[model samples]
Target: MTLIPKSHPRAKSLLIREKLVSGFDNGLVAKEGLLAQGRGEAFDYLLGEKTNQAAKRAIKAAAAQLLQAQKPVISVNGNVAALCPKEIIRLSKQIKAKLEVNLFYTNEKRKQAIIKTLKKNGVKEILGTNSANSTKLPGIDSARRIVDKDGIFAADVVVVPLEDGDRTMALRNAGKTVITFDLNPLSRTSQTANITIVDNVTRAIELLISESKKLTKRNEKSLEKIISDFDNKKNLTENVIQIKNNLTRRARVA
Candidate 1:
């Protein structure tokens, strides 16, 4: 007898999609986010739904950066908010970071829905609703370019999970330390980030929160050392090698 009915790859993938649909119905995820999740699911299926070793190191580094941040802000887009709203809130509380709702596709109702969803997840204060004080991220033409005045604008460190390329690049250019959770090592978001965890956002976020909790007791010197020691290029290369190795093994098994 099967312990988990969706244990098979095909079935399990479908189940993940179902959860996104559930999030969508509950106003936790936007329509564009639903489509983005579908694309991410396809990529996850290819990587065997496992977090690689390099990604693990990256997660720890990301946590260190968060712990050291004097003014850290977690950028909550549709995909991240839907996938791990509660976890995001927990992380914010843990690191004492601000939770800001920043989306590529923005609208009044969707922003309200996201805020409502976050509140339902027990978040008391959510930022990014006031577009009256807006700042633009250069080179990104979408609504994602628009950041709240007091949110991402003033942050020393920003955690942008599952982000698009242009925003990541723009943020980096503006001199803010960026931490990203992108699956593909080759993606611009991963490459541009100060620290990139090339793992599933859900898994990476939880690990980041866990690491941050332990790192909270550590001093700024230690945390900064973690960031200083990290080499994004080297890590990205290792992730690429891991992907190649996994593909080869999968082909052999087939």
Candidate 2:
């Protein structure tokens, strides 16, 4: 990792880039993952690189949904494994959700590398690595369709950070509630998710863990109410409006 001064304006972004570079070098992140991160970063810049009110609302809903779910699973890919393995492990443990490794660019070596990263961060068990128990998700042709029978296959709710649109739709078709972290509100993954946190995953994930902890004390009815009140389409519209407002503010300054 490069030594980035905290005083640097782009220190956090620089650090994230370094992590991905390290991940790729270590065989944990695919080359495509680097490109995806850049795309998300562009949207993050548009949103001012902070967690907004709409994202907070979606986070709260996601936490509630996770708590209420009988079987919740956090789907991990190379980018998620590289960027926030520790946080992902913590959130999975916090909600008692199973952790599953699913990738669009599937390969045995990269899967093992991701599993290794998670294990280093104190993950006990990970699914979706074994082909024997793997099952295909309907409505998607991507490699992400392969899911563990006991993990994503049986899960009622799934947390997919930095997900693709096709799998998001497929999961919904499979009768699962999908919670996703996406910076671009207009993206297919964002629009298709049941609860879309239109914010940077690195930032929103910690908040999701915290919110999950708080929501655990609430009764089942309370948790259900939170999920019911949330409207994903409306939430996405709010995020788009936020971006427009941000652009307008920036134009005024110019």
Candidate 3:
């Protein structure tokens, strides 16, 4: 947590960029992740750096779904590992879930680097790089296709933060319940997820963990109700409207 001074409107955004650059230098974030951060930041800026009501509902539903899962797994990528490794670990432990690494880059070195970073953040049991004990998502032909036997492959629920489009589709097509955090409400990843939280990972992960703790004492039927009542398309549509409204307000202010 560097204390970057926020003197300008873009100050916080610049701080985010600096953090991503630092992650890259630390061998924790991929080069493309830097670009992804910038793209997400644009959306975040439009959304006024706050989580919307729809996203909050989605996070609540996500927690309930994870609680009801037989095997809940959190899908980790370089961007997610760089942004919120400790928070990811905390959410996984809070919901009694597994952590599995799934990268779009498909690099052995980057995979090891992400694993090392997660280990640095107190992750003990990581599931990646063991093809002997691996399985693939049916119809998926990407770096994310190869999941560990005991990881996403076996899990009934998966939380994919900073997810990719094709893999999210593959996971749903494989009949796995998918929850995702994508800053862009219109992304294919957001559209494909059963519950999509359209917020920054830093903010959304902590909220999700908090929500999970509160919902743990509830009954299974109640939890299933929360999951069953979620509407991803409607949620996404509302967020899109929110973003548009924000932009319209900004235009008027300017």
Candidate 4:
């Protein structure tokens, strides 16, 4: 027996359209995100759905940073809520980070629905009743909410999963350390995040939980060192070089 139904015409299409529009509005995706979802459905695939070594390291760094912060917040969007709500809640608990529901849609009913889902899964203390603050980052042209009505503005670190580049940039400009998960290495969110995990939100979150547990057993200095060592520019440069080398190797083999 099939564990999950093959398809639902209305449900599937509505889901697809929501993701496509959200991605477009957020700026990390173009029309292509929709196309990819269509293809992914054939094989049970999802966008930003894979994790790797780089992602693990980034998660570790992110965990360390959040744990070290006086105040840290985990910013959640709709896709993140659907994809890894449990993991998100787990990480927030591990690091004592506040959970904030921030979305591009900016609808109270939708936000409450997402919070209800999170609460059902045991997430506590959800914040960001207000919409996200608008930033000057490219592509994101509107305001979005920050979870900690008081703390988000003062947080030293903010973990944002599946985020848009503009908000990521804006958060960084505000002097808060930004951590994010993005599948595409070339996206602005990846480049702007202090620690960008190039992996699926689910896997990356799992690794972050593991890393937080490990770090919690260590001294604070060690944890600080780990966060300090994460250099976004260097990491991006390294990823580019690796990709080019891989392409060159493939050409040679061909």
Candidate 5:
């Protein structure tokens, strides 16, 4: 006799649960990934689902990069849409970045449904490319050619949330600034991003919007300084070391 049956009302969430379990089983998500997600969830809860200092800095740099762009593009995937739909639309408007829907799940009907959902939430322009989108950027294993009608290819900056490693590396190789939101600091996406926020999308986007609003027009130099000082590898290394030290200290105390 089980206290909680498999067919309980909570079973409805099984869809997302199964996806997470599968990701873990397949090595797409690791133990560290789960820990990161837990931290992000806590941050999200504490900030009222808003952003924080580190997240704000990352977002400001991202907005500045896009504002300085000749043609900015916001790469949208399913996770981004599900996590931060309204914020995505808001960020696009603030930076004038075009929305390009790129997903690993290559279902036409589902893609259309996502687009429709975004439009309903006030996203005016959403571009979906064919399954053959390819880039010269090394390590980018995109299933479709990323269509950049706004000349995203020519832009100096791209904001890619929950991005694939291959695309991030390729974008960097193309001489474009890539700002990304990733939970796992060790992941390829984090390693390749110019400014990688080790925070969840919900918190990251809100913080970015707030920072962008407070920024004046003549802060390009300051923004550039922020970008220049951001060391992705260093930050990630520091985070890992700190967590390990804390764990060790706790063990000794125990």
Candidate 6:
């Protein structure tokens, strides 16, 4: 990893890039994962590189939904393992949800690398690896369709961070509630998910953990109310408006 000066305006972004580069070198991230990160960064820029109010509402709703779930599973991919492995573990522990490594660019070596990273970060019994237990998700042809029976397959609610569109829609069709962290409000993953936190996963993951802890004290009725009140379509529309407002504001300043 390169040593970036704190005084640099792009220090945090640069550091995130370095992490992905290192992850690619270390076999924790696929080459395509780097490209996906760059794409998400562009959306992040449009949102002023910060968590917006719409995302906060989504996160709160996501936490409530997870809390109310019969069995919640958090899906980890290569980029997610590379970016926020520790936070993912923290969120899983906080919400009592299971962790499953489900990769799009799936290979045994990369799968083991991600599992090893999670294990090192205090995750035990990570799923979505055993072929005998893996079941195909309907409506997707990617290797990602393979899901663990005890993990994503059996989960009532699945938290898929940095997810692809087809699988998000497939999960919903399979009668599972899908919660996702996607930066682009217009992306299919955002539009299809039951609750979408339209913020960078690296930033919103910690907030999810914190919110999960805070909401744990509330009764099931209150948690249900939080989930019931949230409208995913309306939240995503607000996020799109936020990006447009930011662009319009910048246009005026220029």
Indicate which candidate wins on lDDT: 2
- Candidate 3 — worst ten consecutive residues by lDDT sum? 10-19
Relative to the true structure, candidate 3 reaches a TM of: 0.95
> How accurate locally, in lDDT, is each candidate?
0.82, 0.94, 0.88, 0.68, 0.64, 0.92
TM-score of 5: 0.72
- Model 6 weakest lDDT span, ten residues long: 122-131
Candidate 5 or 4, higher lDDT: 4
Model 4: per-residue Cα lDDT over 27-56, one tens digit each: 423344455445434322222234545566
Candidate 6 C-alpha error for residue 144, in Å? 0.9
RMSD to truth, every model: 2.8, 0.7, 1.6, 6.5, 7.0, 0.8
Q: Write the per-residue lDDT of candidate 5 for residues 27-125, one digit (tens) a residue.
A: 334444454455545433333333345555566666666666667778776555554678889888877778887655445654665676688789766
Worst 10 residues of 4 by lDDT: 40-49
lDDT of 2 at 131: 89
Error of 2 at 83 (Å): 0.6
Give the poorly placed runs of model 1, Cα more than 4 Å off: 1-13
Q: How far is 156's C-alpha from truth in model 1 (Å)?
A: 0.9
Tens-place lDDT per residue, model 6, 1-254, is: 99999999988888899999999999999989999999999999999999989999999999999989889999999898888899989888888899998988989999999999999998878998778998888889999889999999999999999999999999999999999999998999999999999998889998999999999999999998999999999999999999999999999999
lDDT of 3 by residue, 143-178 (tens): 778899999988899999888899989989989999
| Candidate 2 residue pairs in clash (backbone atoms < 3 Å) | none
Once superposed on the true structure, which residue ranges of model 3 sit more than 4 Å away at CA?
A: 1-3, 6-11
lDDT value, candidate 1, whole model: 0.82
- Local lDDT at 218 for model 2: 98
lDDT of 1 by residue, 1-254 (tens): 12436556566556556667776776667787777776776667656688877888888888998888889999997667667888999999998999899877777777888898899889888888876878877777888888877878889999998888899988998889999887777888888999988888877778888898889888989988988888999999988787678789989999
Off-target runs (Cα >4 Å) in candidate 2 are none
Candidate 2 matches the true fold with a TM-score of: 0.98
**What's model 2's lDDT at 240?**
91
